[model samples]
Each structure stands twice: as C-alpha cells, then as structure tokens.
Target: MAEIQVNEDEVQVGAETASVCPACQALLSDGTIQGKSVLYCTKCRGLLLPIANFLPLVEFLRTLRRPTGSDIQPRDNSDADRHFTCPQCGKSMTGHPYGGPGNVNIDTCESCSVIWLDRNELQRIVMAPDHYPVYSRYDSGGGLRRTN
Candidate 1:
C-alpha cells in the first residue's frame, strides 16, 4: 500500500497507478480509466474495462502523476467481470475494485454519479505505501452510505 499526498492539503492514501494502455495512456477510447469504466477501445473498438471509473477524468488524472516513468506491475485480476450496481446511482458497474485492503473500496458513480467507498477501502488506500496523485479531501468520518 502506498500513500498519496493529494494537493498538499489532504493526503489520500493508496491511489497508485501504472502507465495506462500503450497508446493513449490516460483516458481510453470512449473515456475510461484505472479499473473503472468499460469504454470502447479506440484502436480495437472492443469493450475494454479501464482501470477504474470513467466518471471523473480530472480526478483520475490528478491522482495518476507518478515521479517514476516505469510501467506499473500489472496484477492478475483479469477475471473480474462480475457486475455490481453503483451504490450511489443504482446503475450496473463494470471494473475492478478501487482502493486497497484496509481502506474502504468505493463504487464510483458512472459518469460521476456519486462516489461511495466502503468502510475499510479508504483507510487501506490512505495507508498504502507508494501513493498515487489524486487526493481525497478529508471529508467522510464515518464511511459508506448504502442507498438501496
């Protein structure tokens, strides 16, 4: 687990990322990102699940700034094709679970519906070792709001 000092003020932990796809690393074809959105790949036009949510590009980009330019050591979570409803919007989601173990994992809203993180996901992320660029402002004290 890494630690990302977001914007100097708030330090959002465990938000590290590797270089995205080969061509346009940041945003995939129809706008996908780190284990988030299922966007149509530009070159292939196939439905590829991005790193996370295709919701907020700005936030994703902000959190992706790494000093080292080497590619990320890709993990073997390739079989994560199950669909779960977005806790905030009730829309079906496709992608990997964002955040680390201790911290709460957030089911990000599709197209920025609303970000909902489970209890441990946030803590695990903040407590990670490497740390990504995007930082979450110290907002939630008690975590996770189940709307359904």
Candidate 2:
C-alpha cells in the first residue's frame, strides 16, 4: 500500500480501497493503529479491523498503556440495538456488547471476518483493567486469582 504520513501516529494509504464508513457513509481511509493497518472513518472516527487481529491489536495497545486509575465505563446498551452493514461484504453486521472488560458495544460481520468499533471504543478497551483469569506460581492448584 502506498502510504503518506498524516502525522506521527497516522498514515493515509492510497485511495484504491472501496471500504466505506458504515456510520458516516464516507469513504473509509486506510491508517495504522499501533502499527497495524486498519480502515478508519475520518468523519466518525470509527474503525474496521479484521476479527483475527482484534485480540493481538488489543494486546499491543495494552503494552503501551499506562494505568489511569479510572474504572471501565459502563457499556452503552443503546448501541447494542444499532445496526450497520459491513463495508467489505455488504452484509448486516451483528451488534452486541463485547465480551471483554471495557463494556464496549461492537459490530461484527461474520462473513467478512471483520469488526466495527465506534469512536474511542478501542481506547476504552485498552484502558480497561485486566479481568481475565491469571495463574500465579504461588498458587499450588494453578487456579485463577485477581491481581488488581
């Protein structure tokens, strides 16, 4: 992809892509978040990421995040009712609360294997405290425990 520097953190890729922003109806522009290529809406600041890259991208962002001592914001139940179509496959995207700590509402297009995140949703996920089970060497049973 041909890339032009939009700033230190974002790059604008060649406009050969047909990805359209589901929320804003604008042409989705190519950009990199934490060095990962993603299509983003300049108007709505929404993001489209492949499902396979979702976890890895979250992990990558987590490494760079600093604890903010803030609680994870409540999930927006309203967004769970919103509908959107996939920019890639033109299929209806399934909207649901993300099964993660951030309480984010996400849209997934199974046929396209892609996810749609609205503005600041990615940041909310990365900033949410760790809630996954953690195994400690101190525990002989290898059971899960909360560190935070």
Candidate that would win on lDDT: 2
Candidate 2 lDDT tens digits, 1-148: 9754664223344353577898989998877766777888877877898898889888877787777634545566877777898999898999988888777889999998899988678878887778644434343434233445
Best by TM-score: 2
| Global lDDT of model 1 | 0.35
Model 1, span 1-148: residue lDDT tens: 8843332212222322331322233322333334344433233222223233322432544365443332222233442453445432446654555644223233444563544332223323433435333433433543232222
Summing lDDT over every window of 10 consecutive residues in candidate 2, give the lowest-scoring window. 135-144
Instruction: Give TM-scores for every candidate, taking all chains together and pairing residue i with residue i.
Output: 0.27, 0.76
lDDT of each: 0.35, 0.75
RMSD (Cα, Å) of model 2? 8.1
Model 2 spans > 4 angstroms off: 1-16, 132-148
